[model samples]
Each structure stands twice: as C-alpha cells, then as structure tokens.
Target chain A: MKTSDFIERLAEALDAESSELEGETILDTLEGWDSLGHLATIAMVDELFGKTVSAMSLRRCRTVAELMDLACGEVTP
Target chain B: MGRVLEAQGASVTAVAGYVPQGRLCNEELSSRYPEWSAEDILRKTGIRTRAIAAPDECASDLAFEAAKKLINREDIDPEDVDLLIFCTQSPDYFLPTTSCILQERLGLSTQSMAFDLPLGCSGWVYGLSVARALLEAGEATTALLLTGDTYTRYVLPEDRNVAAIFGEAGAATLITKRSDLPGHGAIGPFVFGTDGTGAEALIVRGGASRHPQKRRRLEMDGPRIFEFCLRRIPGLVHALLEKAELDLDDVDLWVFHQANRFMLDRLRKKTGIREERFAWRLEEEGNTVSSTIPLTLESAVVSGQLKPGMRVGVVGFGVGYSWGAGLIEWTHGGMQ
Candidate 1:
C-alpha cells in the first residue's frame, strides 16, 4: 500500500483525520490512541500489509512515521 | 448431514455442565468502570452475567458437580466408567493430578484409567480425540471426558482486560464405545494443529517453572488473538470439511469455542456460515477456556437446539495456539 493510502487507513484505524495524521503527528495525542486503538491499528496494518505487528512495537511507536516505518519494514522485509 | 456414516466407535451419549453459584453480572462491571455500561457489555460480548467460582471452590469441585449430575441423570454407573480424562489448565494441586482425585471422588473403580490433559480452549476436542483413539483401540469401553477451569482465580478482579472475558465452569462429556446402527454423535474424522511459537499470545506466566515468583495471572493480547482467529479459523473449517468430504452446508450446527460473540459473528461472516447453522450461546458464561465447547453442547441439548441425527462441526481454538476440529454425529437424544 502507498504511504498516502496507509495514512488514510491508519487514520480510520485510529479514528482520526487523515489530514491531521501526518508523518510527524504524535500518535499519543490522537483521540483513539488507547488499547482499542492499538487493536485497530494492529488489525488494519495486518489486513492491509499482510504483516503482524507485535503489540510491543506498536506501544513503542511515538509518531505516525514510526508506525508507518514499522509496517513498511515488516511488509518489505 | 444426510450422508450415512460407517459404523463408528466412541459416540458421545451424554453431556452436562456446572457453573458455580457466584455471579458477576454486567451491572457490577458497569458500576466499577463507568465507561463500560451494562448495555455495552451485552452488546460487545453477548455476556449478561458471568459465573465466578467462590474462593473455596476449585476446578475439581465444579468438575465433580457436573460429573455427578451426568452420572445420575444418565443412569451411568461410576464403575462402568473405565476411562476418566480431566482437561484443565488449573488443577487442584501440582503434585497429584486432579483426574486421579476426580476418579476416586466420583467412585470410579481404581482399575479405571484416569489422567489429566493440560490445554485451554483447544481441550475438549483433544480430549475427545484421545478418548476416541483409546476406545477404538479396545482399551476402554466407557470414557468420561471432563473439563473444568477456574480461570477467574488468577485473573485480577480489577483487571477488566481478562476478568470480563472469563468465567468459571466445568463440564462432563460421556464418550462410550458403541457402534449401535452407526447413529448420531459418533466421534471421529479429527484434525489437530499446534504452534508453540505463539505461546505468549495468550498465557499465564506466573505458575510454571519459568516464572514461579510471579502470580499465575492471565495476560493476553486481544488484537493478536483476534488476528490468529480470523486468519487461521477459516483454514481450520475448510480443512475439516475437506477431511469429511463435505461442504459447509452439510453441517447441521457450527459450534466454535465460545470465546466471545464478536469473534464468533466475525468468523461466521468470514466463513460464510449461515446464522442458524452457527451456535453462540455464551450469554451467561463468558469464556470458560476448555469447557466452553462442551458447555455449549449441554446448553444446546437442554434447549433442543441439538437433536439426534445431526452432523455438528466442532472446533476448539486458543491458548497454546493449539486447536482441534472434527465432524461428529449427535446421538444423545435418548438420554436427554
């Protein structure tokens, strides 16, 4: 999936705005950045990229860029 | 369901489940966590009230209650019970196997073979698989497969993560070696899968040799488990159908483990199994680990949802990343 598409899907997953969820956006500041949000993100990334992200990695991600990088790395690797 | 089966051994003739008297209704949960309402619990999990075992109640207590009920209700002589298998992640003690205690308490003959199986949601089918193999091998004619777990014992009452999802219960399933006219509830055509790599996905880290210092509390990653179920269960269903040489429509009832209502509904749509064909009646008992499948069967039997001459597809998945599936013909009509 393209970065832009991934951003939109991730926004939907986090229940945030696509425009607001830029690469630099702090994921913790989002309204849906909680346990359920982690679940949604995990599901969305696995569904879209065919990669399973460990919960620990998601917990470690500080920004949208890092999360995206993790998914991209998993998918590309 | 219409296909005739060859004479089979080890048919399940009776099933009974027992839940402790304690109750943890959703109202209480909503009171504790304002964000979660009673309606939300019912809507999200399809659980109204969860059965909790009292502090004094252990897994064996629940198992004994159910086993006694099945024995009396079905007029099964304890001596006739030649094989007793208890499946549980929670045992009365670490030294003596709980199955041995159950055998003596239930008045089964000392000669009766008794043992314990350590598994969670994947337990019932595994127990049935072993019982079927043993019975077919002429090791025993009567087999009683009992499953009981007090998961709530370890789950922190305040930890909504797992407390809300688990309930305590025990169940007894009687698998007798019989080939009378090749009728329903005949047990066979089994498929098993396991992945020890995902052992940490759903686990209790405190009790065993690895983490003796920590308390035996259940910790789970909901998303990981959800992904596992969504991705693997469809393959499991397909594999079972292929082994049985039947399609989804041939199944009279589809009873997956009563993990939760959401997962069951999602799997139903994902697998394209119709609504009426699936069973999701865990409104009272949340998730009883190994006992979920058999408890569901007992409930179905009482409600008349499960009748004789029906081909039922049963799958028990979770914990150990382990799973077992099989297509069985129901033959418990006369006993009920």
Candidate 2:
C-alpha cells in the first residue's frame, strides 16, 4: 500500500483529519488513540499490508513515522 | 497392549443443540450501555441476539437436553452408547466429573465409560478426535461426544466485551461405527495446535488454585485475540487441507467457529475461501464456545446447505487459544 494511504488510514483510525497528521505526530495525544484505535490500526495493517505488525513493536511506536515503520516494514516512500 | 495408527471407522450419525429460553437482544444491551447503539452492535459483531442461560441452569443441564433430543431423534438406545465424553469448561462439579453425572442423567448403562474433558471453544473437534480414537482402539463402540458451555456464567454484567460476544448453549453428537457403505462419511485427517502463551488473551484468571480466593470474571483482550486469529488461521487451514490431500476448491462447505461476523469475513477473505462456501450463522446465537461448530454443522444440515457426500471444512479457535481443523464427509440424510 502507498505511504500516503497508510497515513490516511492511520489518521482515520485515530479519528483525526489526514491534514492534522504527519510522521512526527504523537499517537497517544490523539483523542481516539485507545485500544479500539489500536485494534483498528492492527486490522487496517493486516488488511492493507497483509502483515501483522507486532503488537509489542506497535505499542513502542510513539509517533506516526514509527508506526508506519513497523507496519510497513520501514516507512514506504 | 496394542494400538493402531489408522483411526477406526466412524461417522457422525446425529447432531443436536439446545439454547436456553433466555435471550439478551442487542436493543436491551444497547439500552444498558448507551455508548453502543443496537445498529452499531449488529453491524460490527453480526450478532443481534445472544442466548443467555437461566440463573439456575448449568452447562450439564443444557448438554442433557441436547443429548436427550439427539438420542431420541436418532433412535439410539441409551444402553448402546458404550462411551460418553462431556466436553465443557463449566462442569457441574470439579470433583465427580460431569460426564459421570451425565451418564446417569442421560441413562446410559452403568458399565459405560464416562469422563469429562474440560476444554473450551476448540473442544468439539477435540472431543471428536478422542471418541474416534477410543472407538478405533476397540475400547468403546458407540460413543457420545457432548459439548456444552455456559460461558455467560463467567461473564460479569459490567463487562460488555465478552457478554456481547458469548452465548450459552450445548450440542450433542453421536459417533458410531460406519455402516457397510462403500463411500461412508468420515471425520479426520485433523490438524490441531495450542499456544499457551496466548492464555491471558481471553481468560477468567481468578478462581483456579493459583488465585483461588480472587475470583475474577471473564475478561478478553479483543485486539490481542483478533491478532492471534489473524496470524494463525491461514496456516491452520492450509495445513488441514494439505493433510487431507484436498484442494481448497474441493471443500463444499467451510464451517469455522462462529466467533463473530467480522472475524469470519476477515478469515474468509484472508484464506481465500469463497463467501458462498463459508458458514456464517452467529447472527442469531453469539459465540457458543465449544458448541459453535456442532451447532452450526447441524443447522447447515437441517437447512439443506450441507448434504450427503459434501466435504465440509470445519475449524474451531478460541478460549485456551487452542484450535483444530478437519474435513467431514457429510452422510446423514435429511441431516435430520
């Protein structure tokens, strides 16, 4: 999947506007960045990337770029 | 001492399930938890109503009802059943074992073999394997595999996560020596797996000896459990197909544990099984733990979705984080 698509999905999962998110955006600061968001992110990654991002690795990601890195196996261009 | 590698000739002769009279519909649940609307619950979980057990009912009671119905419907004499296997996580008693009680309650002969196999979710498949093993070993001929769980008993009213997903039910399956037919139905070439590491993902961590006095209600990590399913199910399905030497296209039906509609849809898409081939019956009865597969199998048969000679791929996953998959050659006519 495209990096842009991934970002858009991450924004959707977090219930934020795509324009409001960037690689540096902090995850927990978002209103919807709770367990449901976490689950949605996992499901989105699995569906889009056909890969399971390690939940542990996912939790350690504090920013958008870090999540993209883990989910995409390094941020896609 | 003698044992044979070939599983003895066995076929599922009858299957029946019973759900208690009580029902907790999505409307009622949403009224209680205003944060979730009835539409959202049904749209997300594919479950609109959940069967709840009566306050005084036990898993054994549910199992007995199902078993009695099966025995009468199949016209099998209780004395003819030489082996009885009751699979449940909620047994009537931890001491005497629930199967012993069932053997008497169901009126099997005193000489019959009876025992409890405490398992959840993956239990019916596991129970089938055990009964087939015993029958093949000549330890028992006609066998009864009973799966019942009142998991609602473990659900606390406050926890909507599990309460929204689980339903109380029981199923009875009769396994007997295949009659003299050239192409008789068979259940086997099974693939089973267990990951104890995932135990905490869905558990009631309080009542056991380790924390006997702490009595905590059932709690589930939805994300964690869903992740586990996402990771493992594809492999399990592939392995079972390989073991059976059948291609995915050869399977006439796919009946996975009715975890929920969302998970089933994901698994179907991930595994590439056709939507028409998949059994999606959880809308009316939420996840019924061990009874889900048998109950769904029977439902399919009664509705004519399953027929004689059809190859049905069945798998059960959850609870202990245990899973098993196998192919069943459907034989019962009218599947009645």
Candidate 3:
C-alpha cells in the first residue's frame, strides 16, 4: 500500500481521525500516541509488508511520512 | 429478576474472552503431577491444559485483551457502556482497583460505574446479575461484564493443592437493554450466598488484614475445600433453580465453574443431569476462577455446541465458600 494509505490505516487502527495523521505531524506530537500505539504501529507495518521493522528503525522516523518511507524501503533511516 | 431482557429489544453486541500465552498444556502439567497424566489430571480436574499469566501480567491485562477484542470488532461503542464491573480477586494494584484502570484504557465515560468485586468462582454470575439489574432498573442502557483472575499471583507454584486446579483468563460480555428476542430472557433470579466462615479453606496466607501482601503465599486446605464444595454446590444449585422457577430438567445446558473435573462430574451425577448438558473445557482452560463460567459458555458457543434459544444454567462456587447461579436464555445462536 502507498505511504499515505498506510498512514490512513494507522490512524484508523489508533482510532484517530485520518486528517490528524497527515504529513508533518511529528509522531511524538500526536495525543494518545503512547508506547502501546507505537508497538501496534510496528505490528501493522509488518502485517502490511511481509517484513519486520526494528525499533531502532522506527525511532528514526519523526513523522508519518518518514515511517512510511521506512516501511516502503525507500529510506533506511 | 427473571424477565426476558432480549424480548424487550436488548442485544448482545459483543462477547470476548482471553487466556495468557504462557501455556501449561496437559503434557507439561501431567509430568509434574505423577499420579495423573495430563489427560488423567484433566479428567480429574476438568482441565487438560491451562494458560498461566506471566509474573508481570495481572487481571487487568487479561481484561484489557477482552475489551480490546470487543472494541476492535467494533460491535459496541466503548462510551455506550454505562457500567463496567470487573469481577476478580486479583486486581493489578492493591489500592487503585482494576476496573478503574480498564475504564481509562477503554476510554469509558467518567459517568460509568466502575468497581471491582473481590470474589472467586461465582463472580461472573454475580456480575451478570448486577448488570442485568442495572439495565432493568434503567440505571444504564448497557453494561460491560468482565471477569478475570490471575490466581497464580497468590498461589505458590509448588502448592500441589492449587497448582493442579487454578489457571488465568478473562471474559467479557456486553449486556444491553432487554428486548423481545426469540432466544433471550431477562436475567434470572441469582441465588447467591457466602460462607465467610470458611474463607481460609482456599485463601492466600498473606495479603489482607490477616496475612498482608508482605507475607503473601497461598495456603489451601484442599480436602476441606473439596468437601465443602461437594456439600454446598448441589444444594445451592437446587435453591437457585427453584428460585428461578426452573428444574434441572428444564435446563438445556449446565455451565458450571470448572473448579475441577471431579467436582463437576460428581455434581452432574448427583444432579441427575446428563453429561451432555455440561459444557466441559476443563481440559483446555482449567479452573480460571471467575472467568471459567463465561469462558466455558463462550467456548461452547464458539465450538457450536451451544445453540440459540437454549436455556443455560450457570453455577459458580468457590473461595470464601461463595456461590451463585444464573440462567442465560440464549437469544442468539452460535458465536460467529
């Protein structure tokens, strides 16, 4: 799935509105986005792409776009 | 107490149950209990294998899974739950209460009533009674009934008395307004009674005014507890059936708290109820304290044995010499 589509799905999984998960919204800036949500996001990423994303890899992504880039294998950091 | 809730238009929007992942299957437990193989032990205890919560996992964790499953299914809005009753003896915190934490995690409204009932075995039935009453009294439109107990937290693993019996799990049900559904009935009269006098029969030596957590370890009088259960449960069930205007013959299914296979089988023989009437998951779930009844019922529904419109009698009896019985008029069919 596309990065935007992935972000939309993540928003739904987190029970947050799609608009709230748009680009430039730093992952840490989102309310109710806690450790559990972080773990869930990683799991969702693995489920969508038949591969594992390391916690170290997830930490490099500051925003949803960056996370999507990492998930798409377009960006290593 | 026995009006048909489903007949009044109420619907069960969701049902969920959870068992921890650290498995103690029949093969493993039988190795520890030499006289009994896992199968024999299951035959005796009505449990083949049981899931044990990790040291860090608490009752709240199991309840969280149940709530999460229900919410993920999008069957009912968390805010729609007006009452959240966590029936468990093992609360995550000694002071704050497990139900309160679940309320926050589930994002239930502050207006909801949240409380933890520190009871064992019969807790699910007691909770269902409370939920039904709340709905009937118009105290709330829907109630979330959750039961869980991490008993291993209180028991010594080496204590053969409880080790062979207790396991960990959680079960949840969304009880909504009563409606006139083909297979559902209002909650039945709950025949509940407690014999606090025999509290020590199956209790932790520590963790109360008497034993405080600092001194915590399970100290059970197994023989005495077995004797007490045998004597008390049948009479209790009889009383409950009479009160509910039901006879043993009228019950299409009997869902008993899986205290042990021996106790349940004996109860079945004594009650003159056929083996088919009982839903046995002991070989799979063991004695999950408060969650057993609901979990067994859920398992039966999921496995397709319990059909819709079946009149199921639920009996919970254990610790504190506490016991309760309730009738669940199946309004819906198999769990899809």
Please provide, for model 1 over B37-83, each residue's C-alpha lDDT reduced to its tens digit, 9 standing for 90 to 100.
78866766678888999999999999999999899999988998989
Off by over 4 Å in 1: A1-27, A30-33, A40-77, B1-8, B334-336
Evaluated on CA atoms against the true complex, candidate 2 attains a DockQ of: 0.47
Q: Please, what is the whole-model Cα lDDT of each candidate in the order they appear?
A: 0.84, 0.85, 0.74
True contacts kept of each: 0.21, 0.39, 0.00
Enumerate the chain B TM-scores of all models. Answer: 0.95, 0.96, 0.91
lDDT of 2 at B91: 87
Instruction: Report i-RMS for every model.
Output: 3.2, 1.9, 21.6
Where does the lowest 10-residue lDDT sum fall in candidate 2 chain B?
B1-10
- Among incorrect, acceptable, medium and high, the docking class of model 2 is acceptable
lDDT of 1 at B146: 96
Q: On residues B1-336, what C-alpha lDDT tens digit does candidate 3 reach at each position?
A: 532433243444457788888777767766775644565455445666678988888888898888788676656678888799999888887889889999999999888989998888878888888887777666778788888888877676576557777789988888887554534655676788888878877777666776455667767665455556656677887897888777888888999888777556656765667887888777666788888887887788888778777788888888888888877777655454
Better of 1 and 3 by lDDT: 1
DockQ of structure 1? 0.27
TM-score quality measure for candidate 1 = 0.86
TM-score of chain B of 2: 0.96
